[model samples]
Target chain A: MDGITRLVYGIYPRSDELRVLISRTERGKAVTGDLRDRISRETEDLLSTFRGSSDIYSEPCVNWHDFFRPVAGFLTGFSLGKLQRYLQTNTFYREPVIESDLSLRDRFTEIDPPENLPAPLFGNDKEAWLTLPSPHSIFQASKNPSGIDEEKFSDSIFRAYAEIATELGRKGIVLRELFPYSDRAPDFLGALNGKFKTILVAHPESRSLPATGRNHKFHSIVASNQLLARAADSYEVPGIYALDGYNTKLEDAENISRKSEIAREILSVPRVVVTSNQHFDFLPRVIADRKLAVLKSLGAS
Target chain B: MTGGLVTQEIGSFRKPEYLSTVFRKGGDDVRKLIERATLETLGVFRDSGLVNVGVGGEMFRWEMYEHLADHLEGIQFYGFVRSFDNRYFRKGSVVSKIIRKSSAHLEELQFVASHATEKIKVPITGAYTMTDWSFNEHYPDRHELALDYADVVHEEILDLKSEWQKIGRDQVLEIQIDEPAATTNPSEMDILRDTVERSIEGIQGCEFTIHVCYSTDYGILYKALADTALQGYNLEFANRDTLLPGINREQRTGYVDVKEFADRLGDRILGLGVTDVHIDDVEGSDLIKDRIEFSTRFQDIGRIRINPDCGLRTRSRETGFRKLKNMVEAGKAFTDRT
Candidate 1:
């Protein structure tokens, strides 16, 4: 696959139309058919743009930041509501999308291909990816409001995620990748691991260096183990572990190396990738870089 | 000395409940409250027609720490897990789960286009600090986690920028990415600089500021700034010089000499913190003025943004307000002189 395809498949797509859907929801308006159609069309356009591309390794055709602004805007806006819901429902801000947490639609009827998403987006030489907050993120997000029943919340999330996954699969858009952006993400790996080909696990930047010193070390380890164990149980193919570099303390490279070794030992996953300090920019690069290296290593290049 | 009472805007104080809920439950109320209070505080500052308003505290949810922990696994070195169960795992990870169980509240603050015409400063904690403070879990290596944190934050900021754009805001928006850990270690400094640059990249229209303090070595901070994309640096001057044994005093003092250091940093604005958050007695305007004058010797000081050494969450409301008022008065006196 070319770079654009890789990026489209590897990275999560943030659609402006989706943001409009979210905005309308924020305003307490029912999603209009026109708005829904626009969103579906945009999603289809995005999918077609990648599906039409012949070069899988070519540099992406557009600046990623520019391309995803609307999506990011929508997600941010949606986050505001998600956060508000956490406060109203649970009385705290629990991170809803960490690894340890449940899926958003485990019990709900699987997400039917979002009516807005095109049918052919993943038909040929293309893959679709979705990025969700980790289970730990749910817990963290819940911290803002203090009155949630976590067990019940987790159950509902699992139900919702299952529904979404089932629906997406029905649409032929394979959920090939999942990114656990926060500490709490590891908890729900079991639900997502079997469903996706690759799961990207993130680590805290502050702990990678000697400068941080024994702070939050315990939490980091447990989250990783949860993800690894879940992935081990769910997938026949080993999961991929991705690391963040910006928050890592460069002052002590030896210590960082040692930590990395320990992590490798613990996670026991295949294909660990290291990202530059700025992860978003570096994530695409790392994935692209690794894809070629993996092909070459396998003698396919 | 100014005689007016210095009361902190309600937004400046992050109550324990607020912190806990944001950390544990994931509510929107904390952010809503913050936005509401920020507007109220700004109104008070404008209504008082005070020459300057000492922006006091920030709404740092500890849950963010867990979020960081989940994404960055190398933080195990920091020993932050003593307080909770499953120190090995960060608390929240899934969006569906978080939304389902979250207790966060939301209150939207409508920003008038006219209000934003004048510079409105927004502060965000740096990826390094955020990572350092959280219980990271996602990445295997600390350096790797740092990079991921930077990316995550960059994404969030980019998203934030788009939201600002939709509201017709422009470059006058001043954003400060706070990095308390930048001064302490070389590795962290490198990460801080790189992450700050990444965070500021593409968001060209705004005035980007960086706040560096509460560390043993400030020299690293200066060095880090040489590589960052920010236009301003806010340094803590009041308590930086106080001796803290076992910690390198030279590094700390070097960090305090930000004015001289920043001068070498071309076109960078300096926000010199004149008020001490730790000091119980309110610092007089004269003392603050002397400090600003002292800072002038280090660099061609442009427009100075005065503030406290750090957030006023630790102080009584009365003390916090008094200190902020004094700092604002001192800044006005300086601005008038210049």
Candidate 2:
């Protein structure tokens, strides 16, 4: 706790049992009760791992169809479009067919976050974060058959998020799967300086992190170990969270330990955060479970 | 002489309702059902006048990625992941050293060989796509994993080609390596070239063509694959171009990459996609003719083979049939005029 701030972001993988129940329920074969209990059991296992392993962790979103879908389901002004490949991965999310201005139909927290999460995590919660795709990401993935201006569309999405953060008193907002879809940095990112924000780059490439000017105090950058090893030296950030979320070779805990030590020295920070760089939703439940024990082992020495 | 701008299919066609339902439920005699469905689809292809039938429109398989991953030794599926709205595919993770457990499409080729009178072009999921689609658990890196996959693909193709020869045919097997994931990762262009070359290298008496459709930028692929042993490219243009009939760059904007392909590569075929498969609105033969005529500006008409953008699996059987029929009519129209 003193030298390293272990953190978890993105959806954790769901168990096979839960997956079966979900499919059955969707097909009208099983009831929602069985599905709910299975998700809780899987989520409890995830939470227990976080208790000793990490300082800050988002609720393991075992039920998210994808990162964007859960949030998109609650928001208005969009219809589901054809499946587009999400960045470089094999997995896909339904694209938004933007029909109207975007806004949340209901409170973002109550609709998307699972019911079992601790009540304490919601109001001004710094310990747990609610994750959403950055407005720019949403704007980029959207299909505007009708022409929509970039700033107007993105601001409409950000206003709803701003309301949620204000209503819930959340201190940390994590926006994930970031990319430089446009020529310049997204304007919403500049307005995100008041509280702690962790920007998870989907694939850390030369163009992954958009050029940004920041006066934000608690801004942090988390990315895959491969990109960090290759070209993360020039990325200036207040905090660097390094994790091997993309590859399944149980990450060498020693390498992460060494990276964290170097990060503390180089970034001139006392404690560096660590978490998986992307969603573990596509990984087998067993491998994702094994990763929890590995996360617990970081900075133990 | 070949039919000018020979008509063909890219790969998948929508499975018949009975076969698809039974495929999900998993009962015995599914193989018989699959064969019946395949032959029926073959009937449609024959009536549509396609010169090259692709395993009767890939009827033996559900998807390109799952079909190959199901046959590999090192892959383990987690659960169903959504590839689109409500439709999902099993995305496997490579947990150990990969090896081909069995040939994915040998039985498929054998079936088509026995039934098809026309020349057969077998569409198999290429090595690069297989590697890019799976999660790597064991490989030291993605490059190593892709190379290992390349070996498996080479072996699978050689085995299939041998079976085709045993049938006592004089024709060389035309293999279309489906690589929809080719242009997704720009950093891995070198890996893409290496994997394609390794997959097709030293396979005598066979044609190696790649089917890469709907790429954001086809220029990357044209330049990167110029030196590979690949014989031609099957790409999509109707998805992006305007359907209002015109033969210029403005109307047929999607065929702009034809100049790049012709300039960079020498003497390669172009599987020109002249119809949009995603939409049900059938392009009349005149519209498809316009797209084919549009490509003649950048690529030689002799080197062009006609096709749909990607797969018609997304469309209904009736729609897929009509689209193919119209495309064939379009090709013949171009042929008669020339």
Candidate 3:
């Protein structure tokens, strides 16, 4: 049985650093081209390390503003654009920033496999899995109000994703998987999975039925399945369904069991991944106590 | 406690000196005031032969922002700072305090359970609403933050169950997790279900109830109930037409068409709302009875618990007591009909 593994690879320091940078930029701190290049290089290095460490999957490249801009623009763009004009009097095509972000993400496909890394790291046996912030995540981060033209935003996102997938395909990347972090990401999953071959859902809750109203995780999967079925009906590219993992709460053994059972049944996907491993702070102690096996068995290995 | 009603004083902790000095000076005196108010209200209910009493006040008080500021960083700090000015409580602190207050309240409920001949009900703000209302920072993500809050609630439930078991009480301890925010986002239905499951994880042996109402959106809420593992659900059926959207004036008149919705939900216990709390005047007993009778069409509904649309916190003392009396009288009438 093929199992899923969570290899944490992304821009180092993650959103925290990006937030600081954005704040600084807003404060009129000149972020030089060299500084931007250094940040990008550091991020690329992190992704390369994550790719080299395991023969399993490659991590998604991070472009902070790109990942954020489109959804933010869609949700708060009108108001933000108005504010920017009133404040800075600069006219900016927000779409170009979003497009450039996609282009930066696509640049990962061109990254030369590090020379010191073993040949198996770039071999056909290993899959290159990239985790993008789900459109729902973008919406959440942007703090956009509901009832926007989500369909149009989803279309644009899927088109950009298709472009990236096509570029990665040329790089001999066999599989491209997108992980939807938020519960509200099913619609985007529905849209993108049509183009991407494999899709993985990481629902955070361990309990509750998948169809419960407003349960976005369940909704996303259901919507994804529905979209796939519709595409199959229309002779569109048939995507393969992979596993769904649960990022459950601590000490919630019963819910974990319940979720594992449900994943086995409803998620026609190939695997069900669970995590017994705690956060980064607890990793050392967990490994020291040989508790890694417990997590490994749950598919976090 | 008789039929989910317990006679207990609303405990009020002193706020900082800057805000309300009256509550600080009158700690014991305030407790006496609440006790006196509760007894006086109970006397009126008893005179009218009402079986249950609902407390209408903001009883639990703690400076939670100050407590939680001690644990958070940067964005979390800014979030809390923004929330503090808005009078919003932190999710972690609120859950922690609820656990503490509920444990004490459960003991008081057990005391009432022992003395009374009927079941005692304890209502709490549900996990979803708590997540919606509170500032969260413990987890890196919102869903994770919600799960963390649910874990806190689960701990409280386990603690309360153990305390009840130690006391050897035969009376029912109905724990109502109030979820008004369940309707706002359909995606949250899953989180609500997960939170409910976590809240009731180990204590499957005890009676668990969920109360959801007071918001306009029921699309996700109805779906959440279908997917949740809850044993009993108390919904706002009264004033259904007036409050709920998509309902025509014809549906609002004298009765609601919740029977079909309830029937579709299968065997879960249905605690139908018989009185409209949003209204200023207390509903007459006959009107409450009619509402309960209308809900009896759903065959699976067991033990119809009569209640107003929500807590009587907004109602006047006389009005709240009169409504409770009418509700109890209506419940007795329904029991007699059965």
Candidate 4:
């Protein structure tokens, strides 16, 4: 048994100081250099506190407007649309509007590993990774006026994303699918799993597995703790169970322990990562930090 | 109907800076400040020519959830969580059996009852939202938690009714159950229907309306609330609408739901959102008239009402005032032309 491993994902909540600075910068009052340093300061605190304690992680994407927003830079045909509610939560994300057929941006096309991609916060730590909305999710949420081919668009997204992460020289990529998938989503995800160490963070109830790919399995799958608590389920993948990401009420230690025990029994593989279900952006910084502290304590059980 | 197109305030306005300061840092003069702010906002409403002034701009409360949860027992807030619009609100977790510790809107209504010259519509947070926003730590299931919250809403409504009775038994008391979270989650649709129905059970001497804001798919809610006891639906549209001014379908795509709303629940009132609340640029009176005229294709002129997409708390006091004044002017202009 690989026992238990802890992981982190998504943007950390911006500090109130940083929020004020962002407001200032938006109002044309603050300098860019100070804002960058202020943004890094919070992540430095997190990394120093628990750098290697968590096995697989995504750097705090506090600067990105939303999950799919940065992906616009990697593609040729999309721009940020209106802010949409992120699934059922109070959090909102800017929907990408595809005015024309999406193709890999010239940088992603010409450069083998684009040297221009943003530097990873965790550097070359093998467990550190980058995440974006799954191609299926992007396809579903985006407004495609030109009626792009689903399969072709999905291909470009996976190729460009894989190139970006491989060049960033990080471990892998996380494909986050919080909403219900389009019927063809499973097939699109299958193609993405063929490259580099890949992990899929889907809804707790989603039963999508790698449909057809060169790599038959993801390194692991992280899902809501609800998956393991269910009375009946048949899942072939090793699971990283997680607690609610949005709620501020601290999860009970006893209950998390119980769910991990259940995870061991239910998952197919021995390696089971435990973590928070979604990004901490929905929560206050202090509460999310406490929750992460709880996550860190679940090492190598 | 009521002889003219009616104008209403959605819920909270930008509380005057002085009152907002008191609300932020509590002081002995908090009540007095709220009363003064309410009276001041009422004067603004009177000048704007509104038919229904919503508790003189909901001045007694800081926000919907924070204000309502503050009055409820068995709910404890942990810390502030970021809202969809980049603001933060203190979301509570239900720890024990939930009950109404006091009325969220009784005093606001009482003050308005004493002073308001215009018809008053009281906006209370609905059960679905109260349950949806709270962490369900104590309940066995979400439905049970929602039902208990319905009890809390029911009690608050009863309390308001008694106050309304004290002032005017012969007059109709208007209740706007604000459910911004009503259609946000489709899984909770059944609970939303059940809770709205449960909240108004055995209640009388009132005209009930539901105000749902920024819902992703309002079609689901038009169907969901079809079985509820609500008599009106105040939905947000202008927030997503194109800004062009015309009385045709192409120029008025946001009013598409008005047709479905009329087809499904024609008898119920449709509180059409004729202005966007997030932007400070006031919609022209002609734009608001075009929006209203578009809805008249499906719903009758008498059954229609107009308001901002949601609360005006996001806008500055001046911006909010202009938006309201434009809405009232457009409604009057439309009625006069008809």
TM-score, chain B only, every model? Answer: 0.71, 0.97, 0.72, 0.97
Cα-based lDDT at residue A83, candidate 4: 74
2 versus 3: better lDDT goes to: 2
Per-residue CA lDDT of candidate 3, range A226-283, in tens? Answer: 4433322221122222211111122333444455455544545443433322111111
Question: Which has the greatest DockQ?
Answer: 4
Using lDDT, rank the candidates from best to worst.
4, 2, 3, 1
Please tell me the TM-score of chain A for candidate 3.
0.42
- Of 1 and 3, the candidate ahead on lDDT is 3
Off by over 4 Å in 2: A14-53, A59-83, A93-127, A139-158, A169-171, A180-190, A195-203, A206-215, A223-242, A252-255, A296-301, B1-4, B21-28, B76-87
Model 3 Cα lDDT, one tens digit per residue, B1-338: 23342222111122223323343344667665544444454454455554443222223223322222222222122111111101122223222322222342443444444444433455555556656554332445556666765765676667666766776757555677766566655656788778887877767667777777644455456566675567766777675533332223353433344654565564776666666665776777666666665566543335455566666544555676677777777667656666
Q: List model 2 lDDT by residue over B84-173, tens digit each.
A: 433456777899899999999998999999998887888888888988888777888889999999999999999998898898766789
> For candidate 2, lDDT tens digit of each residue in A144-245?
876888878767766776776667666566677445433234434545545435444443442434433435432555543333333333233433545555
* TM-scores for the candidates: 0.43, 0.82, 0.44, 0.89
Kindly give the stretch of ten consecutive residues in candidate 4 chain A with the minimal lDDT sum: A111-120
Candidate 3 Cα errors over 4 Å, as ranges: A1-301, B1-118, B242-257, B299-303, B333-338
Could you report the DockQ of all the candidates, in the order they appear?
Answer: 0.01, 0.35, 0.02, 0.37
How much is A202 displaced in model 2, in angstroms?
8.4
Error of model 1, residue B141, in angstroms: 1.9
Error of 1 at A76 (Å): 57
Give model 4's DockQ, 2 decimals. Answer: 0.37
Relative to the true structure, candidate 4 reaches a TM of 0.89
Give per-model CA RMSD.
19.3, 5.2, 16.4, 4.3
Better candidate by DockQ, 1 or 2? 2
Per model, state how many residue pairs clash. 204, 1, 12, 0
